[model samples]
Target: MRSEDALANIDVAVLAGGLGTRIRGVLGDTPKVLAPIAGRAFLGHLLDYLSAYGSRRVVLCLGHLADRVTAWLARGDSAGTIDVVCQIEPRPLGTAGALGYVRKELRSGTVLVMNGDTFLDADLRAFVASHRLSGAEASVLCVTVDDASRFGRVEIGPDSRIRRFLEKAPGSGTINAGVYLFSAAFVDRFIAAGAVSLEADVLETLPPGTLNAHIAKARFLDIGTPESLAAAASVIAGRES
Candidate 1:
């Protein structure tokens, strides 16, 4: 399928189940995903960007203050014409586990996975195309950042295979932007494994050739910390999807 066509058909799973330990002080009772940036919920901005995909299906994997997040989603202010639904986790289910919880709802096709707390403006069309071309079970959106110390770095081999996943340290490297494209079969295996982190378990254990990397220097932001959240408003202000 073409990139835009794939995006429209793909099921988008936004991981919003994280407990905002770092930002809870700033946001109080509000879930981290609902933290406002530039006069809108951070999720609003995310959905705005995702609107470009012309996708009408979005599944929010919700935890920690799920009720509040559900209430906000109920207001119907964030998703525009998209159909946004929440899959509340009974308990903390890590990354893969959360996805597993909602596996039944996912259609048979590629699924686009994104981090709710981080925003990386990678080209979806190109990313999806790369995944389709690679014939890998999963593909990661990698970004060449000046400093990779803040995040775990991903090393790409000559064939765009993920060769090494390096630990965080002060330096430069290409890092996973926390966006992924996965085939339905891959997701089924992940869900069957149960209670695993998408990165630490699935990605880390997969063969290098199974995970392709598409590197791009996209506009990015991580609102996991107070410092980043404070900077979000300025960074995202007046930006259009």
Candidate 2:
């Protein structure tokens, strides 16, 4: 199915709850999602991108400076093409826990979740179509980067089933892009099982063939560090142009 069609039934979730300790020196008290990029808040750019794909609604799981982010949303920072909602974490919940915190607000059977600080320039239509075709309970977006030391490696079999997740180490390898598609049922299961870290507590524990891998050779941007954050404006401008 085309992304627009698939997205009509799939809500997008942005995980913006990280402490962003690495970039704190530059941003001060601003939430990482509200960091300025290309003359606009990074969250605005992200919402514009999602709006292009006709995403219906976006549920932002916010922590760290949740109030600031929420205040920005109230100011109409979103692109106005999609409905945006905030789910503030009472306390810091790991990635999986944050999702569980907003479980009641998600209206879709499947949800597309991605990190607020990372952007993957890929065809959402293809990604969504592949996931729907595979019938996997969960699917992860993976990309091969020159240095896997920053992000852990993901091993997928020839069948595209995720086999294992290796801890971050010095090497060039395929790594999770921090974007995932999950069935509501699987998410509920994880919440029930008390899964915390999405990677370690849930993904790593899943059987070898349980997760599908949607590998793409796309430009990946992560604004988690000073260097990367500095480069985001250019990357985002390039994408927009």
Candidate 3:
């Protein structure tokens, strides 16, 4: 579905709380989101993309040198419309914990969540509309990836409901695109499960047919390591040129 018609009332949550342990060798102490790509901080590019799609509000879940992020966002003033929420996990609380920490703030309606380290050329509107219409507790953005061995792969049933979630297996399949549209209630359930992976803690635990998948048409990039970051930079540069 087209973005214009799909995401009329959804809020966006960008998970930005990682330590960047993998890329620290290259970026040294810089938050991964602040890593330079195409002459601007990577998070800036993400915010620009979200704004382009008429995002109602953006909540950035920040941690690990989060002060730098706050200062950077403050200096730009472009993020004034974006809500910056801090999720300072005493230690890495894993992905689901960060979301749980902010459950109260996510007090209403469905929310679109994306990992700070990956990018997908998805129709956000269609993703959200599909989640709402499916009546599933959660909807994951999925894409066919050649190297499913490095990512969590999801299996959807004939009815389009998620049947199983496999994390980083040595095989090929449709993988999680690091983007999701979830009903608020589903997030609360994730919080109740304690600190664990989103895929392992929540997606895997859902009863059959409760979770759905929305296939996207965009290129997918996971920017977790230096190599992937360089690849993402090249992709962004080519798009601009």
Best by lDDT: 2
Tens-digit per-residue lDDT, 1-241, candidate 3: 5554354356777788988888989988789888888788888878767766766567777878888888888788344445555555566677888787766666448888899888766667777777778887788889997778888788888888888887688766798888888888777766876847886777777787787888877678888888899888777665446
lDDT of 3: 0.77
lDDT of 2: 0.90
Candidate order by lDDT, decreasing, is 2, 1, 3
Give the TM-score of each candidate.
Answer: 0.95, 0.97, 0.89
Which should have the higher TM-score, number 1 or number 2?
2
Ranking by TM-score: 2, 1, 3
- Quality of model 1 by C-alpha lDDT: 0.86
All candidates' lDDT scores?
0.86, 0.90, 0.77
Cα lDDT tens digits, model 1, 1-241, are 5434647877899999998999889999988888988888988988877877667788999988999988887788886777887899999989999899998878848999999999877778888889989998899999987777899998788999998798998977789999999999999987887747999988988866779999976867889999989988876773563
- Enumerate clash totals for all models, in the order shown: 0, 0, 1
| Candidate 2 residue-wise lDDT at 113 | 91
Predicted structure with the largest TM-score when compared to the true one: 2
The per-residue C-alpha lDDT of model 3 at residue 94 equals: 72
User: Which of 1 and 3 is ahead in TM-score?
Assistant: 1
